[model samples]
Target: MAGERDGETLKRRGLMLVLSSPSGAGKTTISRALLQEDHNLVMSVSATTRPPRPGEIEGKDYFFVEPVDFNLMINRGELLEHAKVFNHYYGTPKGPVDAALAEGRDVLFDIDWQGTQQLAHKARADLVSVFILPPSTAALEQRLKTRAQDSAEVIASRMSKAAEEISHWSEYDYVVVNDDLERCLAEVKAILTAERVRRTRRIGLIDFVSGLRQGY
Candidate 1:
């Protein structure tokens, strides 16, 4: 918690830190770095139809589900946000996210602009959205190509999409240019520190302050 602390009391609400970017913009890497650095934060694991890669465990990387089950979640309003990506439906399940926030734990999101917008509308008070941009178009193209799975055509498609995605940068509370990974991570860490200290999140502060004044 980043706010004022009186005596040995705990205050402050949990935060939803959303990091959004186009495919090659390094949001995922930055999110992982943030999690490693902060013990109080955890990544919001998404449920997807996408298959797990070689080393990824079922629940650890993502909650792999069949299309029917995913649609069931969507229909039942069990998903906080859902979107179709590259023919697969992916979403954040409402249960775990709600439970984590209620426990005063910060949750991180690596999602697209659409998902970000949904989260904002659903939990505006708890949301802190950040958009990440690569230094240049050429750099973004190169980064996309670095992945062997994507063809040149796919990379080009992603690059084109990146332009559209970056246009929504104004919607976010913070924008970070990922020219260097370490420096970008440091900036994100600072934002988290500042958000934790926000007065609205610290619900226990007023009572704590009053007790302090009374010399309790």
Candidate 2:
């Protein structure tokens, strides 16, 4: 439906669809679901100084780089946003994102509040940010424990940080509570569908309207 046409084909400028949430709040799950369903949406692969895990392909999972190279990219303004987490640097490369948007392909960003703020400051018109929240703090903690990926100490740290993360909910354009996964996914999809058709986003609407006027 994104490139659908009634008379003259309508073209839209691709938007940066950002989904940010504290750990275990369902942002990753929702992002995966959206990418699977939407052919035009692609995840923005980031460059990281961290080593890849088993079966992780370079340029696919991430562009694994050396710390020196990462620093060079940052210095050269090639990175759209960069952050240090747990002694590793991760960043979004500006080139790929710019190319994707220019070609009318939406780029999905699974980043934090810091990255979202940086993106908003750089490209406010092209950004559509959503913050996901858990139904309750208890639920959030449970979800983190169920993953079993972290130690109790790490989980505790994450739970402590979640509150501070949730405090930034007002900064996002939309907020969805992940009480029910299916319902939340549907609501997010609806938001994307509506955003795609917005008059301002549809870049070709003016030309289409002009054609109609000429016919009249």
Candidate 3:
């Protein structure tokens, strides 16, 4: 879609952009930067059965619900996609994402490969999934340790799981190596920009083109 302007016509359909990567591979950092720079992009808030991490906020970082409540949401069909990771339930709420898509606003998801697959099966047309990779295992481990959020044991566990997470990279539409954070962010933004204007995603394209032809 063209850049947003006041009173602009020719509305464009929005998309669901999923960014999946192993823990501490910079998906979250890239997501934060993308949201900061793109006014049209909105973050998808997931409800999780896990306790809040430091500096995490309710309704922003996550919904932070009990396991029973999370299960209830699942049984009630409130989640667009739900998955269990490390014995905790995490899910994307369906209502908010549907509302954002209806309003022609893009929803950015920082989820796992499982959630991405679920969304693809549900709404593949609106989905643009990207898998971010670390430059190397050593680099990935270093980045995880640098974040200081996890203990040695937790870091080791994450490192062990990274291989399995990365094995699903082929399922994504795009794969970016996060050797340089800024460059990776730029590449992800480029993909978003190109996808937004795809012929199928724009509404009323045939009519708009016909009107233009008549003007000649």
The C-alpha stretches of model 1 lying farther than 4 A from their native spots are 1-8, 50-55, 147-149
| Candidate 1 local lDDT, 1-216, one digit each (tens) | 323344236556789999999888888889877888789999888999988789988877899999999999988989989999889988999898888887789999888788999998888999999999899888888888887779888888888788889999999999999999999999999999999989888866777778768975
> In model 3, which range of ten residues has the least summed lDDT?
1-10
The TM-score measured for candidate 3 stands at 0.87
**lDDT of every model, 2 decimals:** 0.87, 0.91, 0.91
Compare the candidates by TM-score and give the number of the best one.
2
User: Model 3: clashing residue pairs?
Assistant: 1-197
Please give the lDDT score at residue 193 for candidate 3: 96
Q: Encode model 3's per-residue lDDT on 29-96: one tens digit a residue.
A: 99989989899999999999999999999998899999999989989989989988779988999998
lDDT string, candidate 2, 137-195, tens digits: 99999999999999999999999999999999999999999999999999999988888
Candidate 1 residue pairs in clash (backbone atoms < 3 Å): 2-197, 3-197
After TM-score superposition, the amount by which residue 123's alpha carbon in candidate 2 deviates from its true location, in angstroms, is 0.8
Cα lDDT of model 2 overall?
0.91
Query: Per-candidate TM vs. native?
Result: 0.88, 0.93, 0.87
Q: Report the C-alpha displacement of residue 13, candidate 2, in angstroms.
A: 1.4
Error of 1 at 33 (Å): 1.5
